[model samples]
Target: MTLKQDTTSITTSISNPTLLAKVDQLRDLNIGQHVPLPQLVVVGDQSSGKSSLLESLSGVPFPKDQNLCTRHATQITSRRDKDECVHVRIIPGPRASEDHKKQVEAFQTKVSSASEFRDKFVDILKKANEKMGLRTDLSSGHGGAIFSEDVLKIEVHGPREDYLTIIDVPGIFRTTVHGTTKDDMVMVKNLVKRYIRDDRTIILAVLPSNVDIATQEILELAEEYDKNGKRTLGVLTKPDLVMEPTMRASVCDLVMGQKRPLTLGYFLVQNRSSDDGVKTVSELDQGLRIQPWSDLPKDRVGILALKEQLQSLLLDITRREFPKLVQDVASQIRQCTVELNKLGPSRQDEREQRSFLSRMAGIFQDRARAGLAADYNAHSSFNQTDLRLITHVVNLTDVFNADFQRLAHSRHFSSLEESQPLESPEPSDAGDRSESQSGLSVDTLRVLLEESGVDKISPKEQMELAEILVLPKDIPMPNEGFTDWIKEVYLQFRGLELGTFNPNLLSVAFTEQSRKWGDMTRIYMSRIIVTVHRFIAATLRSICPEEPTRIQLWAEILEGLLDCYRKAMAQADMLIQVQQRKQPYTLNRQFAADLSKSRGHRITALLRPKAKEDRRFAEPQYMVNLDDIAEAAEGKHNTELLQEEIHDILHAYYNLALDRYIDNIFQLAVDHSLLHGPDSPLKVFTQDWVLNLEARQLEDIAGETISEKKRRSRLSKKITDLHNALKILKSRDSY
Candidate 1:
């Protein structure tokens, strides 16, 4: 059997050894044989011992230490053209600047000056290392080091005939993400987040035996992958460096325990010099030959023992745990697709339901965030942004609907066209979205919604489908600038005045963050995740029947969603109060009525009264003062007083915005509570509360005017109050 195309597969051989034994001749050169698998990704922090552990796992030695020890992400696939089937083939991680051809240039340029790799690559790379602030494994030169990058592919054939693909990431230690600016932490965060988020990926943290516990940086990095039960394994690499197994065990326990999502497994491994097949340094002869670990002492001989333990653990994880994950992905794909199809172009009821639920979820989340942040004026901005974002996001459904339309129009399709309907829906890459038939998100929604109804899709299905949607990548960068506004307001509360540069408070100035979720939304990012939770519940229900996964899982999910919604409601409620504060009595009563009304019923009703309120509350000198305020100087006429006056004018604007932020958060919290219970806080709001807030605000502002001196005095009082408020919050639990 050829490595590239063999009837033998890693799993197939494990379950059926007859195939593996038949290929023992191992001397045939063929390319068209083998069931191929995707390359495995081994990721972790640098010097986490990834290299040594990978070699040990694969039972193939290539290079050691920091010596060319994965300077680039490498893909270890298979190549069977050789007489002997190669076990693994490596393709280095693609660099974005690959086309620059810097490494290739240096290779060719200096190599022309000399024939030896040592004379060219090693020497040039050494100097380049210094310039790049990178480390070089310059000892014997070409051991595990890499310099050229026309895609350095490495092939290794193992004794066990396990032809599996593997990916070796560049050492995270030296891999400092280069950023162009101070606030460019976004780019670094994005890169790190990407590496950690790929659900298909597994994290392999390799550390020296001396690394008794992971540092906060590494732990935090690892936590990014912890959610969704991503498999993270800790390897005490260079166990040869540490003399005791007990020490290795202790380190693994401490590090793994401290990490968020518990690691899949742990290993103590070492790489002996020269010859490779992953035996302990003590097990190998000076020439580096593999040896069966005999009755050797545990201390010196245990690297081999450690290797055995890791292999056993890996075997169990692959055979048992990993398959369940794959199954979950499969189920989610089916469910999402089914639901989306129901809401497709033809299903008016489903589409309407989908639309309502989508709006419900959105408005709730928006209010929740605003309320949580105490940003009263955020309501309007959120509504405007929501209008804009949804306009674009819902448009994507049209894209999905259009496709479903074609399918129904053409084939009267009962199933999506594919090799296996069970396959996980593939997401579209940023550059090539058309390639994937439907995103797992799109498919899950369509399928599930379609299936839920008898002759038509059920309302529950529509909501579930919409809920399962993959967040659209194309929503024009939402008013992340609002985050800056939040920071500004926070600064103002701290006596930093209205305009200030405050970094500590503005964590991630872009408000493109997902809403603070209830447990449900948090777990439902992938349509697949929902599917898994359902599958577990469904399958288990067959045996132990009453454990409703939906109600159980969703109960928690709902609580969080409601928390978000309540926050939003409170915010919107506050903003109406602010508007009322400035309005005349009759207008204030109208504002109260509108605030109490359901947000969607007839926004016009809410707006008419509020617009009248704004009119009545309008300062007699509003426009002229605004123009004067806009034209205010930066001269030495007591800038503070001028600023204070400007601040008052802006406060009106700010207060309006604060309402929106708070409302959004409240809504988000409410979204989580949907499935919690009938009496869930997520239950719709009454008009009374909104009106009450308006009345209270009107009373509060009875003597409060937006004049220069009044504005200054109010600012002083509010600032002091806010300081104490923040202190209480901090002392409570540091939300």
Candidate 2:
């Protein structure tokens, strides 16, 4: 409600708060056991609908309404912490760590041979994901291509900060620099090799719907990337490219292979097809389709396969792997200390680089306190959970403080002496400088450090520098939504039920079942959350949610988070089992993936035939494939049926809420609760009732929309005056 009064910091706007704040929060949540916002790294060549798929997955209008969602290996980490924005960063440098040299070498090679510097930047994350050994090979450019090792980092905000990290690798092979695409299995292998320090991360490699499993990368990435070498689920992006359900199913089978209990599932996405604007949460959910192979069109069969694979994986991760990830990433961080010592120095500096958790404490406390205040609720069960949340924050700081501290200040110590002279060797050995066991010479390290603006530091000190910050790594997003403590305030003060669970409450648990309701609530809640979030975010930090079209921007962001919720809730059977066994009956767990249906696109007679000029594109490419689009649209109602459904769903929700509203208002009135007070449930309800009663006021506002008679008269007069002015100007010029 309060706008920013502070103007000292120029970057602080009504969008993002601060970059450091976001990182600090990410670190705290991560340390506090919420780490690794798993990302679905969608990789492909330029214009291969990589952006389109991301847009669909992220629910952003993308190409139609915004610029490239990615400039590098950009990741869309879900807003898992709280009021978070869909942030994108062009990787400006590699990560700073003891192993930073390896990252630098990989990026340098990508930069030297690449057609675009940005692709090299993307290579860093792709390589990092590859190292983690996940199926991340489904890059978009020049068909599928393999991503050489690169550094990748992703953070998300929702109910928590710690989640999976899905990386969007560079669309591949557009140039000779990017190599080739591998199967999911290979992608997984590479991802594990590079980024997945533990079991916490999963790679969701995106493939074109037009392409099939026969594409070596599609099949191979799964083969190589799958857990225990099992196949991966496929995400058949752009279902509009294919229409036949039979073909879609076949593709699903072909990509899924012969895995027991099926290793994959597909999902149909049309992020680009969001023709009408979406304002409410229900609309966001009506768009995601996580159904069976038989139910999907030929193009989405791949997506369906991917969805199934992911669903099963999600269940496995939540059940079997989650606990282990906590242990593993921690172990890996410890191992990083060992790696730092083994690779470079005998001891960590433990000075300049404080533990991530330690450096972030102040930021965390400020955010936590603020978040608690904003999200305070006397009746909710979680009201008592705040102390626990704060405790979790402190506990996390403790768990990783030692490990992070050791790693953070590694630079204050040196891996090797700056002046350590290289032993002169034979010509044959001289050619292998990079392959040398000791790495580049101290002089070389010092020179490199100096070039990077560290002349005051020694080569040993440079080596001590964090590998995550070495080269031009991805730039952090503008601090619009980043905060140390996230206070998520669901817009509906009185919780609304999308299904069995209170939509507000159901949002906390990340399951595949509650996703639908979660989707609906997210959008509906966003209308209020984003407004307040922007106001506070600006006051707090840098970057504001400054855009000409606020609704479209919101729709774009809400759409993406909505996708994540649905994806998380896609596995209903397991979620239901877990909830019934553990706690309450939640919406997603109760009703996700209950139907195997489609938006059912149908071509109408009035629909113009596809000519050389595809109406979708303003201009016709000489090599336009009219049959492809026409065949794609075949029986599909390529119409606004989905939007219509969303409209119905929203009004239904409003109608349902209206009943409760009326009853509550009547109850308060009977109790004689209305009084002169600033804060009271009865008073608030009375005010709301009055606002609702102002139908006449709404009419007055609506009446101004067209007012053609007066508007036209004013415009006509202005035009005459303008004509006269032009004449006078012309005369003056002549004189």
Q: Where in model 2 is the C-alpha error above 4 Å?
A: 1-40, 43-48, 60-71, 80-165, 174-200, 227-231, 243-249, 252-262, 273-319, 329-735
Model 1 C-alpha lDDT per residue in residues 410-505, reported as the tens digit of each score: 111111122323122223232222322344455454444344321232355346544443332322211223223443555464545444433322
TM-score of each: 0.29, 0.29
What is the Cα-based lDDT of residue 590 in candidate 2? 17
lDDT of 2 by residue, 1-735 (tens): 111111122121212222223322333222312234222335443445666554433332233212122323444443334454333222322232336444333432212211232223344444444443323433344322233333333333433222323455544332332223345335434443343333344545455666654652533544444555333444545545566777666655544553222243444444344454532222322344444433445433332233334434544444454444345445544554443332221112222112221222333334434443454342233333222222222222232222222221101111111223112112222222332123434334334323433223335333432221122222211122211111132222224434222333222322212223222222222221222222222222211122322232233233333332233223322333342234323243212221111112112221333434445767753233556555654453422333223322322332233233223322331112211113211122122332342334323321222433344443443344333332332332310
Weakest lDDT window of 10 consecutive positions for candidate 1? 26-35
- Highest lDDT among the candidates is held by which one? 1
Candidate no. 2 TM-score: 0.29
> How many backbone clashes does every candidate have?
100, 158
